[model samples]
Target: MLDLTTHWAGILSVIIFLSAYVLVVFEEVTHLRKSKPVMLAAGLIWMLIGIAYTVAGHGHETREFAAHIIEEYGELFLFLLVAITYVNTLEERRGFQVLRAKLVGLGLGYRGLFVLTGALAFVLSGILDNLTTALVMGTVILALGSESKRFVTLGCISVVVASNAGGAFTPFGDITTLMVWQKGKLEFLDFFAIFLPSLVNWLVPAGIMYFAVPQGRPTPQHERVRAKPGTLGVAVLFALTIVTAVSFKNFLHLPPALGMMLGLGYLQIWAYFLKRNGARRSDEDMVLDSFSQIQRVEWDTLLFFFGIIFAVGGLGVMGYLALASELLYADLGPTYANIIVGALSAVVDNIPLMFAVLTMDPDMSHGQWLLITLTCGVGGSMLSIGSAAGVALMGQAKDGYTFLSHLRWTWAIGLGYVAAVGTHLLVNAATF
Candidate 1:
């Protein structure tokens, strides 16, 4: 007899996952619906479904799965909230404005501007995150966009590519990479093994864009803005936020949420002091305003993530993930599987995919695991909507970074992706 009950549960989970993803993508491509409400709705729906399944079937395992997700991913949620809040607050303090003025003040021609912006975006993405780096750099491109739309478009694309490339080299640079790291699926230094290839990924696309840029005369420098009075304090707090976040994650062995909670408290205190003193109330208002700016944050993206996580977890619980892993190993072997996984990341969010792979726990060499890391990290740049960096930039530079504009650069990004994956293969082969 057919196992109708098991099959139905699996089908329901898949439907929920696909529906959530479709809704999010629809919102992104068409702007027909609001993302936050959709995501919240998806989360609630999945939570109910998951509960139903637990009651009807494996209650113990389902409860354990929910608990594990809370314990492991809870910190990540806190990290996201704290990190976004901090950046929003700092940007309101004119931190981004100051950076923008400086970039414009360089008075570089199209070529120089492209190079400087690309390089800055890459480096900044490594330290902060590709999403923030892309947004900040996109702002600069928008500010100087009056020079040439082509130049602005090329510059924005280059920054997006560079940000993703640079982010691939560090754990903190991209969320997918961080998830892999947290799972102990890949080590910290193991990432550096693929660093050279990641550089190639950025440079190859940048080089093409360089040739395409028009040979125009340098523009006059824009007037620079003076740093806000509390700019230094903001910067210091930002640095401390990162340090404290890492310490909590690494030293204290606490979830990142704990660290973020503490850091937020510290930031609040600092803001309070600034308010009490003679600091301009306008500055305080700006900071608070930035919090509202977060309303612009993609609610759909986060919701899609939650739905996928639950759906995938459901699949794994049902042994589908295990069967898939076994089939891959038996049919294609590990290298090709890694490539396929990487390519799939361009379409699906890499977080759930990486987690799915981790659950499968394939028997592979360390080098092969590193290859997975490298491929997954860089492969996301294949499309505009593939990575957080791309999405954030699109939102930040909507005028210039439309879907079609990104499509124009897709071929270049593909070359970089290929180069990165190829480099990883070579390094893995050599090391093994």
Candidate 2:
């Protein structure tokens, strides 16, 4: 029947989304398969299926889908490439090592390290993503070792919570926020409207963990490495790249990718010159190793994201999103709907959920949209697998962190989640 065909397309879109999520989870749990390739394959599969349905029934051109994918997501891909390149370059130069040495040198007791590391991860995540923040902090914790297992676990959980909470305030901090921004669903500074609430999300859990952490003796001071002679140059170059990228985004109306690409090129050139300019053997070696570290970048996450975008795009094309939006809005209403959506983000990827919401175009005031953004952004800390920080920490520090270990912190996260929502409602009520 004609009706059946329409419904089938919608069903296929959901199936594709679910399938990609399964692959992502499987990759995380098994570690037997690579996620990037699997994600790419899944994306292509859904794209093909979408094309088949569109062409067969709707008389849509296949090229239109491809064009849509490029036009809509091209900048995102570029931003990913550039961001990855920058992260890889800094990681290669031991950017994080400097921080690690400082933390260890603080001679902080186990409790101090736990609190400090968690706070740092939370703050840093506002600038970088939660995953990178977690990776850097988690690595530091791992370096600290089992002598501080309790502290390390507490620190990791705090970092996960803080990172997710902090990420909600910025456009670049989380994928869901970024997707929503890209779709013109929200503005950049508008996110800060809920900043107080977002901060509360981390503070609540962090405060709890602060008390939960056991006191221990201070760690012995570790030897500090002198900054390489050209460290300043590398740092400057890095700053310039970021500045240029931001300039492109704000002033030029260019895609975020343009800045990232320019930055990547600059780093490569800077590294080449540094290598050629009689740089010390140690500095040169560090730079070389840093370059190599790019290989370790999680390509799987990127591919998985790509697949999800396409699958969701397919759903958008099918008109199912509109109907689903109507049903959800009617049944849940915006206030409870926002909470339910945020909670669901713990199990499902918030990126697609954000996309689905964008498709829905709920008629809401700016404050309400801000609430949605804040809740979804901070809500990811609810579970270890809920956000990038959790997943990345799990993968990079598998020896120490497990899903169950993260689950132990759920009560703390839940408290934070509730506090964040409550704070947002209070702030909104007072303001409006």
Candidate 3:
């Protein structure tokens, strides 16, 4: 392959990526879907890579790189597809709506809801990915329809932080942790070592931000919403799916995506049974069809994942990430390097950043591996544009949560970031 360090193809690809990312960062103002520019950039960058490699008489190498990148993307794509489909299936069955009704009926004050939502986000993200956790909690926060923008703003920020911190300690929580786990850098149970630290990461900011939340409950809307038949079964199936995914990775030695797809089949079969029984009796319940549920997923967000993977993969193929790894890990050392990576994750997607680190396959202890996992997983909480959860919430909450709104509380999040790191060092010192 051609040397991309100073090559025209590399230079232009970097420019294209940065330009597209700028548009993505200002998506609220531009009214542009975050996926569009990155998709275009991914294609453009690959085209440049293809051309450069062909000119250098290494065209086949470009094909290999594309194949590898596609495989990586495909695994994540399928895993997320099943996860989103299940979430959608639950929503279609009025699962979230019923839950929302229950929470709203509580008539919790703003401060109470703030803690509740954040706490829920943290716990749920351990089972679901951070993005889904944030969206679920975000729905509840938005449902309040509270005229208080400050409440919405604080609630959204709290959820974002909680989701990221919560996901940091679980293999299935964040893509970064999943990548680390999949790479055999850490074991499944080993992730729990950082659980306390992750909790600290969330609680620090939450405790500090608690005072800012306004008092008084929003007017509770009491809708006697009930989940349809099989809702409980679906939840059970989802739990089984999580088990299947873990079993696939740990025991079967198969890709977790396959297990997720099999879990999707569990939903499909149940859906068929539900349809056979004609379970839906009211207008509130949507037909329980898994395929239709799949259709309801956030395609924009999925496509954004597609764009990010390809764009960053292209950059990795060009050698920038390896160079970065050497600079960060070799010169700066593992601890500081991991910390800086966390901060960078606030700027760049942790998926690609972790992917690059796994690809570089640096020598480090178990503690260091866990440290990077914790940092990358929660680092995105530092900025609104940092993680998928934050970005999705910004769009979901609209004017209530913006880049500037999230930026205003960066110091608190940064403190949480530092606290989490220190806790990890102290708690997991045995691993080192």
Candidate 4:
């Protein structure tokens, strides 16, 4: 392997990534998409690597590494695209809105709604990504009691914490978990081992914040929203799609993306039936076009993933990640080092942090791998800016769940974080 630890290309690549990341962190203030700077940095860094390695007469090795990175990004991209497409289809069918309406109609007390939304986020995020889970449950909380600032604040915090925690226990839940799974570090069922710890992570903070919820039912929301035709079928297809993906990975020993793409066909066929039925109905109740939902996938986020992978892969090829692995994993050891990785994730995006860890390819046990997965998944909840769920909720409920509001509860969240780590150490000690 080529070592570019002291190479000028390595130094310049570091500068480019850090500068782009600064823009990413300040994206709200700058009114710029997080994808733009990183995309540009990925291109520039890779271009430099191509040139440097080619001149050094290691063009073949460089090409092989670049191809490997491309393959990695491709699998993740297709899988997420399919997942987002399913989510968009559900949204179009009023699946989420109907749930929100039902919750609001229940007229649960502030505390009840808080626990319910948090719990739903915790469970739903295991199937859907944390961002979607947070958004859905956050909307429910807003509708359930938008007038109560106290309720909204507490509810938003809980949703963020729960969504991140829930995503930790399932491969489909968060980008970090998916990376670990796709890397073949753990089997599909192995992720469930952390479910208890993930639950404790959310429950601790929720129990502490429960008392602070305002008392009384939210203002009555009497709106009668209904699901579109084929809602149930679409949901079933989504479930089947997930099963197919897992089966492909676990049974067929194939790339999960292949199953996800194949599942896209199931949705298309279902959409055809809906369109044909809607044409016969005067009210156009079943008139969804699945292609439109495909267009609604979060392209910016997908692009951001592409850029981060390549950029980090470039650094890995330059030998920076190896140095990091030796310093963090080798010197501090996996337990402390993994804890620090999780803490750092509270400030940085967990995607890149996990990607860097994967790139480093440190030698660790199955329990240590699970430890990193749990930490990266939930660590982002310590601050509103730490996770996509928190950031989206901040935008969705601007006046209620501001950065300071979340920061105020950081101590409680931090306590939950520690408890989660301790619980895993105690309960999963046999695995270690």
Query: Which candidate leads the pack in lDDT?
Result: 4
lDDT by residue for model 3 (1-432), tens: 456968999999999999998998788789999899999999999999999888888888888889987887888889889988888888788887887789888888889999999999999899888988898899889888457899999999999999999999988898788777766789889999999999999999999999999887798677799788889999999999989988998899998889999999999999887776774544334347778888888898889889988998898888887788789899999999999988999998887688878877788999999899999999999999899899889889999999999999999999999999999999889998
Displacement of residue 271 (Cα, Å) in model 1 is 2.1
What is the model-wide C-alpha lDDT for candidate 3? 0.88
Off by over 4 Å in 2: 1-6, 32-57, 226-229, 279-283, 286-296, 396-400, 428-432
- Per-residue lDDT of candidate 1, residues 5-30 (tens digit): 25665566556656656766666566
Q: Over the stretch 1-432, how does candidate 2's per-residue lDDT look in tens digits?
A: 112225655566566556656766677466645455445544565565555656668545545755676676677776766666666666655667788888777777676777778778768877778888888888777777567566667778888888888788877778877766666666566777777898889888888878767777655768575554456666677668767766776788776568777887777777677676645555445344335545666676676667666666666555666666767777778888888889998998788787678766788666667778887887778888888788878777675777888788889889889998998888877533
Candidate 4 or 1, higher TM-score: 4
Which 10 residues in a row give candidate 1 its minimum summed lDDT?
1-10
Residue-level lDDT tens digits of model 4 in 1-432 = 678779888799999999999999999889899899999999999888988888899877777888999999999999999999999999999999898888888877899999999999999999998999999998888777667999999999999999999999999999999999999999999999999999999999999999999888777777789899999998999999999999999999999999999999999999998898889775487987999999998899999999899988888988999999999999999999999999999999999999999999899998999999999999999999999999999999999999999999999999999999999999999989
Candidate 2, clashing residue pairs?
A: 36-300, 92-290
Candidate 2 C-alpha error for residue 125, in Å: 1.0
How many clashing residue pairs appear in each of the predictions shown? 0, 2, 0, 0
Q: Where in model 3 is the C-alpha error above 4 Å? A: 143-148, 215-217, 279-287
Model 3, C-alpha of 240: deviation from truth (Å): 0.7
lDDT (Cα atoms) of all candidates against the true structure:
0.72, 0.72, 0.88, 0.93
Model 4 regions more than 4 Å off:
none
Weakest 10 consecutive residues of candidate 2 by summed lDDT: 1-10
